[model samples]
Target: MAIMVRSWERLLLASIHDVSPRFESEVDSLRDLLSPHVGYRIAMLVVPNHWGNAPIVAGSPFASRLRDWADAGSEIFLHGFYHRDQARHQTRSARLKSRFMTGGEGEFLGLSLEEASVRIAEGRKVIEDITGRAVAGFIAPAWLYGPGALEALEEAQFALAEDHFRVWSPATRRKLASGPVITWASRTRARLASSLLAAGALRHAPLQTLRVGVHPPDVRHPLLIRSIEATFNHAARNRRAARYADLLD
Candidate 1:
């Protein structure tokens, strides 16, 4: 029975991260590029106000597109409030994770429970207000969460939360799946090369589930764009695209 279940079919899940009114054009390009491979099955992680600037205003044009995206079956996730790190670093580990894991976009790092709750509640409300539907989950900016942020997610009862290593339910505290999230970086040459190489290797990896992530910068780099589509084509040959919410089913 285990073998039969495992043999049913592998699944591929993909997402567009750092989604905001700030990068609307890049987001649209990514959506158009990915539709052929994933067919709007990608999750969108939205920042309510990117860097305290590009807020998803109530009746803005971008907000309307967000609602349309949700209506078309793309899952949305509350990414962060400001999408910028402002909390004082209270520990050495927190400091290192913020510095090395991401630029300065780890907004949830070093947050107190109360602070994290405030951001989460408001961010969720903003997205829900714009989309007129519940978001699929909450994913911290740069996938870095301080302990307070993790607890706050559960307190608010978000259905799912994902990091680089796994996707899990914050409410139930259950890790539904464990796998690496394949993604590309375009800020530097070496990092971009390494990511492309990793994607090439992952194309043929034997796994029951594969997850890919795209950021707005990826659309601007031609080579990374090619690699993205290539990875999708090769991986999708065997695994069908699936939604994050489908994990519960």
Candidate 2:
């Protein structure tokens, strides 16, 4: 007798990170593509505090637009206090230089517990000040957090923390989900190929929760844009959009 395997219904959640002026156009494009699919429960990461010397403020017009979207019911996560790595001794390879957040590395990864806690508190304040709403979660820069970082988040009272491919609960220090992540690639062809590959992989896996990550630059590439749209369309056909908050409850 042959046995049949049953597939579970998967939850789809899309996320975007690394917001900046240079990528405004691409961000806008992404917003447009995602607006119609708003029911999918997308999330944006906002950077408000950091150690880098960059003068860009989080309250700029571009950020305001993103905030507006969040106000309209989309989820928003505090990306990093500064998005940049500022510890003087740390060195990033050339390939990673342009990719780091603008200000330099902020105070999370290498700071002492006391220092990290202060930064986390300050960062949450900045985000709340700008958005006029309480932030539900935090995501460390580069998804890199020191051993002390998690404790800092808990003290600051953030309900959740999102890593590169996982959603964690600071309170329980347990992972809620680590789904497939679809992030942007620097090369256009590479982005499309990765998206295509990810789509196929999703089809083969037992349905669960799927999380996709997008950088603003990904939307600028026509091929990548199409691939993202196609991916979302495909997922919608197979599963319903699930909220990250819902999983905790």
Candidate 3:
């Protein structure tokens, strides 16, 4: 008797995080690299205001590009208003995660529900104003959010939200996918460690939905760039490339 194995259905979502005018050039380069493989299916996690400094305005070059991407089927997600942590420390664990895990990019961590709601609304408005389209979703910086962040996301009416491990609908509370993302770290040692971890995932995490998060800094490192490409190529063998919207569909 001949036996057949059914391959697991898997989804692959790629995203460029911390996108803002500050990293526009790097973001473009990464997009160029990704387009050939995934077309315009990648998502852009945009910072409406970067570090409470540079704000993305309507009719600007960046905003124009965002519209182009959105029209081309790339999703625009409202990342944190300021992709920098400014909330007061609420706990030792939160403080440690901010300082070490996120490198101070977890803007939502430790924020009160009201404060998080206000920021989420503000950021979403800026993106909607520029794109003239409703922002597709929201993803907190570094995939870290405060206790009230989820509540605020629901109140703000975002269709979707993502953490490090899963994507879920804020309104319906339906879990769309379960998978750990493969992403690069910043420093040299950390980058090397991430490369190994990502390689391990490629080798072992088959038959599961996978998310690959690409940051501007990852494009700067040659090794990390290779790792990102390799991961994509490996996933392409069996998994279908997808946008966040595809998951919801």
lDDT for model 2, on a 0 to 1 scale? 0.65
> All predictions: root-mean-square deviation over Cα?
2.9, 6.5, 4.8
lDDT of each prediction vs. the true structure? 0.88, 0.65, 0.82
Per-residue C-alpha lDDT of model 1 across residues 122-174, encoded as one tens digit per residue: 99899998999988899999889999998899999888999988999998988
State residue 161's C-alpha deviation in candidate 3, in Å.
Answer: 0.6
Write down the lDDT that model 3 would get. 0.82
Q: Tell me the deviation in Å of residue 228 in model 3.
A: 0.7
Q: How many residue pairs clash per model? A: 0, 10, 0
What TM-score would each prediction reach against the true structure? 0.95, 0.76, 0.92
How does residue 244 of candidate 1 score in lDDT?
Answer: 82
Best by TM-score: 1
* Candidate 2, 34-88: lDDT as tens digits: 7676453677776663234332357688567766766776677877666766554
Candidates ranked, most accurate by lDDT first: 1, 3, 2
- Residue clash pairs of candidate 1: none
Point out where model 3 deviates above 4 Å. 1-8
